[model samples]
Target: MSQVMKPSTAAQKLGILLSAAPEDFQQTPISREDLDALRENPPQWLQDLRRNGPFPRDVIAQKLGVSNSGLARGGLTDPLDADQIGELLANPPQWLEHERSVHRKVVAENERLKAERARQGN
Candidate 1:
């Protein structure tokens, strides 16, 4: 017998928002096999989500090249689609730009620290 899990668990495994999922999907408990099948051979809805997105906050942050905190500070708490992300990239808002800069600086600092640690052989 297949093991079943909560919708939220399935959504986490799928890297999607449970609320963003279809109503039926939100209501259903998914099996492990079902999750595997979805991963292995995604349906049209999953494909569309992966491609077009109303992506999760983490994905949004990654796409925007900023931290999750930056997104929050920029007042982008809601999920964002690919088109919306694209629009932001094309004509970034002041907050977005600032956040991107901050992200870049943070990344650079992390890289620098990593290199320093490597050089110290520790």
Candidate 2:
């Protein structure tokens, strides 16, 4: 017997919106094997979604090079599609710039701390 997962869980694991998924996908639970197969050889719809997404918060944050909290602080509460993300990249707002700068500083600080710990044999 195949292990089954909820549609919402499948959507989360697949990194696509449940609402945007096909009716069959949204309505039906997926098997573990099927999910793995989807990952290994994605269908056109899956490819399209991954490529031109109203992506999840984490994906949006990654694309914008900022943290999820930064996104909220910057007033980006809605999901963004590929076009919107591209537009933002082309003409970044002041908030985006600020968030990016802050993210850079945070990353640098974390790296510095890691190096210090390594040197101290932590």
Instruction: Give me the candidate number with maximum lDDT.
Output: 2
Q: Kindly list the per-residue Cα lDDT of model 2 for residues 1-122, writing each as its tens digit.
A: 98999999999999987888899999999999999999999999999999999898888999999999999999998889999999999999999999999999999999999999999995
C-alpha lDDT of candidate 2 relative to the true structure: 0.94
Each model's TM-score, in the order given?
0.83, 0.89
Q: Number of the top candidate by TM-score?
A: 2
- Candidate 1: stretches off by over 4 Å: 1-4, 119-122
lDDT of 1 by residue, 1-122 (tens): 88999998998788786778889889999999999999999999888888888889888899999999999999998899999999999999999999999999999999999999999996
